[model samples]
Target: GPGAPAWAYAARRHWAALSPPLTGWMGHADPFAFAPEWQPAPGVRRLLVGTPPILAMTALAAGVASFDGIDIAAAEAKSAALVSVFAALVAARCPGVGVDAPPQPRHGAQLVVRHPHGRRVMAALIECGVIGDFRPPDRMRFGFPALYTRFVDLWDAVDVLAGVIDTGAWQDARFDRLGKVS
Candidate 1:
């Protein structure tokens, strides 16, 4: 969340037609003048709402700076390769689990898989230090960020998943209790 800041972009031609739904003082052309009526600032400045979160902005700047030397194309290629390998592994070793992502180049940096006991399985994986998230009904989502995730991590994760499924480790009652954030 620190790195992922909310933003918007529009073509120069569309600027006049755009209006922020929630107008705040910061979006006024002359906020200090305290005019009787609302006068929006020019361009994207009109989209601003309220005071900026300085600390969050600082964190966002730092997060963005962290990617200064990264080659986005290379990162994307690595992500595709990692996702392909992970999907293949899941298809081969994990019998009951179904790879939910589309074929290579069509999918994103994450891989989703479906299982009957997806929630419990995800919890078990988390316990084993393999962090993943479970969506409602039957999907487990795993993000393979090219900047950090390694190829061996996918192999190890799959191995642990296979073991968990084959041994019925997800049957544990501790995994059934849902937390607020989960």
Candidate 2:
């Protein structure tokens, strides 16, 4: 138990439950693993298995994850910048008409936030193609995945969203009433 995490064996063992070595990210171990609390069935094999595409995709992700931190940071900067610009446009065109959810951040260089509004507004954005991620309570998140988002695309995304709110297009009768993962 002494000196047992990557930083030491103890820390590794600590985070092991939440983060697995799925992509070589897990190297921590604890002696209590074989205890009754945890056990792996042996001599069992499933007939349906081996998805090569999944393995290939995972390999691609691991390779990307191994990119230098500086490069990732640069990519993130571009993405956040573009997304922030979009959020600024949304804020500018559709000034908050006053929502009871506490005043939210209007805009910033690296923050692409929007204020809470009715559910129709959210579904409208999704239908427009910007994969908005929904969070609990009332927050919509957008992931401008750096490797592929362009500034023009970002502008267009927000412009369309502005139109949705301006014309009540989001009132289309199909969005789920309940909030989901963002």
Candidate 3:
């Protein structure tokens, strides 16, 4: 997650017709030749805009490599299941908290919940090591990426959230002050 790469895909037939929004030396066919005009490199190389960040790319490569032999479908199912379990737990234990997503199979890999004091609640949760972010108005998002998140983590997070809400721990004045970045 720290070094995730941004990638784009185009069909082979459309490669010749496509034009890169940004043109940089790395995308040139022969960057060292000092050519008079731009000559795009063959295939997807033409889409590269700048010199690659070697360290970031290396990390990205390793991150991608870690997925080798993993079943993506199974991962998706596990993510959905984890989200479902989390939502159910929140409903049962955390009164006044409501999920803001569609049912399973329609929802993505995260759970967004709404609460009157969502921002402060999220801050308290973060303090308890259950990291989640709050969106404006009244939304808090918790991500459960199946590759890294385990089922026990979901239970722990929901438990912390319930404790924060039940004991009025989120009422701490420190949690009310908003950060520059939400």
What TM-score would each prediction reach against the true structure?
0.84, 0.55, 0.82
Better of 2 and 3 by lDDT: 3
Q: Residue by residue across 47-86, what tens digits does model 2's lDDT show?
A: 1122335555676678667665648668767765776566
**Predicted structure 3: lDDT:** 0.87
Write candidate 3's Cα lDDT for 1-182 as tens digits. Answer: 43344677898998887789877788899988979898999988888767667898898789889999999999999999999999898988889999898866887898999999999998888888888788978899989999989888988888899999999999999998656655
The 10 consecutive residues of candidate 2 with the worst lDDT sum are 40-49
In candidate 2, how many Å is residue 80 off? 3.5
Candidate with best lDDT: 1
* Model 3 bad stretches (over 4 Å): 1-5, 9-22, 29-32, 36-45
Sorting all predicted structures by lDDT, with the top scorer first, yields: 1, 3, 2
**C-alpha local distance difference test of each model:** 0.88, 0.53, 0.87
Model 1: per-residue Cα lDDT over 1-182, one tens digit each: 43334677778888777788878798899989999988999988888767767888888899889899999999999999999999999999999999897767888899899999999999898889888888989999999999988999999999999999999999999989555655
lDDT-better candidate, 1 vs 3: 1
